[model samples]
Target: MEPSPLGSVDKALLTLDALGRAGADGTSLAALSTEVGANKSTLHRTLAALRHRGYAEQSADGTYRLGPAVLGLASAFLAEENLPALLRPALDALSAEVDELVHLGVLAGQEVVYLEKVEPRRAVRVWSAVGRRRPAATTALGRALLAAGPLSAGPLSAGPDGGTPETEAALAAYTAPGTTTDRLRAAVDEARRTGVATETEENEPGIACAAVAVLRAGRPLAAVSITAPVERMTGPARDARISALRELLPTVLPAGLAVPPAP
Candidate 1:
C-alpha cells in the first residue's frame, strides 16, 4: 500500500495553490472547498490556521487570498539561491548574440563584484574573472546600477566628516587622472536618460562596455554588461550592441527580473 499523505499539510498546500490561481479577486469558501475536495468545516479550520500564520487572508466579501507571508517566503528563497546560477542562461544567450563578453555584477559598498562571466568564441577577449572586484564609479555595470538607484545611502554620499573621501577614492582607483566627481555624476545622468551605461577605455585599457541594470519591483538588484574591443564599441557598432541588449535581455530574463523602462 502507498504511504498516506500528511492530510492537514496537503490540504493547506492545495488551498494555497487554489488561492494563487484565483488571482486578485480571490475565491469564496464554497469555491475553495470544491476546488480542494475538502469538507467546508475541515477547510475552514485550515484557512484559520493559515490566517493565524499570516499566510492567507479573508477579505470583507468573505473571499480568501494569498497574504504578505507569501512575499516573505519568496524573498527568503531568492536570498538563499546563488544569483550567478539564476542568471547564467540570460548571460550566455546575450554573449552568443552579441558575440562579446557578458558579465553579471552586483554592487557592494563602493565596489561592484563580478559574480558571473560568459565569453563568446572570439580570439581576442577581455581579461576578467569571477570574484573580481572593481570600483563602482567607473565601470559600466556599476554605473548602470548607480543610475538606476539613489546614491545618498552609499559611498557617494558625504560622510560624517563632511567629505566624500570614499567616492573620491573609487574614482581615483578606476578612472583616469583628473576625472572629477562632476564628470562621474554626468555619466550616471546620461545613463539614466538612455536606459544604459557606457565606458570607453575608462575601466580597462583598449576596452569598452555597455550595461543595463536588472530590476525587481523597481529596485536595482544587479547589472548585466557587454564588453568588447574599443573599436567594435563605437559609432554604428556601439548603437547596434546597445539595441541588441535592450531588445533581447528582457526576453531571456527569469521571472521577477526586469529591465527598467527606457527614457
Candidate 2:
C-alpha cells in the first residue's frame, strides 16, 4: 500500500523544523528522525526525495543538510507566511515606479530565492518567480542580503543550481559571465557600506537590478529589488533605485522577527 503523507505537508512540515534546528551544520539521519518524531525508514525516504531533487544533500561525513533547492521553496513559503504579505503592497508600489519587474528575495545558502515578483505589463519581461532561485554571489538581491547580514557572517558558499565548483574557481571566480568573484566581493563590501547593492547585466545580459536589504534585529531578513531594462538603466537612475529600496527597508522588516527562532 502507498504510504500516507506527513502532517498535511504544510506549515508543520517536520523537515523544515529539523533543518532549522540543525542549522548549516546539517544533521544525521538518526538525529533528525528523533527530532521529527518519525521512524528512521520513513524519514529516510522523505530525505531521499529531498536529496534526489537537490533539496537536501549528504555531506562527505554522511550527515544530511538543507540543499540549495529547498531555499526556493522555503522563501516562497515564508514570503507568503505573514511578514512579506504585509509588505506586498509596498513592493507593488515600487514596481509601479520602476515600470519593470520587481522582486523580494532572501539569501538561502549561496543564493537568493525569489519570494515575490511584481511583473511588468509586457509579455517580454524577465520571467522568473516568487519561487525561482539565483546565485547569491552572482545576483544583486542575494548580494544585498549577504552584505546586510551580521558582520560575523561568512561569504557565500557553493550551491546546487550551478553545481559543485572547485574551491579555487568558486571563490576566486564569478559564475556570472561578465563578473569576477573579486568584483562580487567588492560589491558585497560596497553594499555593506552604502546599505544596498546593484548589478548591470550580470545575472542576464541586458538586465539591470538594484537591491536593498531588510534587516530585523541585526540579521538580514530579505531584500527588495528593482529590475530594469539595460537601455533605461542610466548610472544615476540605478543609484536612485537603490536609494528607493533603502527607504523601504525599515518597513519591510518587522520589530522582532529577525531570529526566526525563540531565544
Candidate 3:
C-alpha cells in the first residue's frame, strides 16, 4: 500500500530533521527550504510554528537550530529510563579490569551519541564527553551498532567517490599500515559475524578502540567500548582487551535474551 501524504506537522518534523543534520553551525532558511523541497512561504510558516513552541530557534543571522525543547525531551527520557542503573556495574567492571576508558553509546541518526563514560584513574586522558557525537563510519562503537543493524554484511563501496571529506580523513589517519578500504570492509564484515569491531587511530590520533554491541532480544540496545592510547593497545595488550570484551559480553547483556534469526 502507498503511504499517506505528510500532514503539516509531519512537514515541520522533516524541517526539524534537516536542522539536526546541520549540526552546531545551524542551517539557513534557504538551505532548509531547498532540503525539504517546500515553497519558501510554506516553509516560513512551518518554521514559525516550530519556533513558537520552542522546538526550533532562529539565530541572529537567520540560521536555525534545535531549541531547548529537544534537550528537555531528551533529559526527561534519560531520567525516566535510568540506563546507568542497569549498566553501571558492567561498565565499572570493564573499566576496572581493563584499566582504561569505557564508553556506552547509541546511534543517533548517522552519528553515535555517548551516553556514559567510565574513566579509569591515571589512564591516558581523552576529550570524549557524555553527550558528544561522533560519525558512525569512523568509530568502533558506531561500527558495532551498524554491523548489528539490518545492514549487516553490506558493502561500503557504493558511496560517493572517496567518501566524505571527513570520512577520507579518518580512513587515512590510521597509525600503523593497512587502513585500506578492503581492510575496513573485512573489519565490518567480521563485526557483523562476531558482534565486535575495532578501530585504530581512525577517530582520533593516538587512540585505539574495540567495541561490541549490547543486545536485547537480538536487537542492538547500545554499544560498549574500551579505548586506550596507541602505545598501550599494541600486540599483546590489544589481544587481551579484545579477549576481555568477548568474555564479558554474555555477562553484561541481559540473561535469556532472544537471538533473532538472520534475514
Which number leads on TM-score?
1
The alpha-carbon lDDT assigned to residue 16 of candidate 1 equals 95
| Model 1: ten consecutive residues of lowest lDDT | 150-159
lDDT of 2 by residue, 1-263 (tens): 44456453531257766876687899998998888887888788888877788877899998988889877865675453554685677677777765668888877777678878878675434668678887777787877776666322444433454324453354453335456765776777667667667787777778888777665556677778888887667777765665556554344444433312211
* Number of the candidate with higher TM-score, 1 or 3: 1
Candidate 1 RMSD to the real structure: 6.2
Off-target runs (Cα >4 Å) in candidate 1 are 1-43, 57-65, 152-179
lDDT by residue (tens digit), candidate 3, 59-141: 99999998889878655644514665667788888888889899988887767888898999874757789888887767888
Q: Ten residues in a row with the worst lDDT in model 2?
A: 254-263
How many Å off is the CA of 68 in candidate 3?
34
By TM-score, how accurate is candidate 3? Answer: 0.56
How would you encode candidate 1's per-residue C-alpha lDDT over 14-78 as one tens digit per residue?
99999999988999999999999999999999999999999999999899999889989877755
lDDT of 2 at 135: 78
Error of 2 at 55 (Å): 35
Return the lDDT, model 2, position 213. 67
**Candidates sorted by lDDT, best first:** 1, 3, 2
TM-score of structure candidate 2: 0.55
Better of 2 and 3 by lDDT: 3
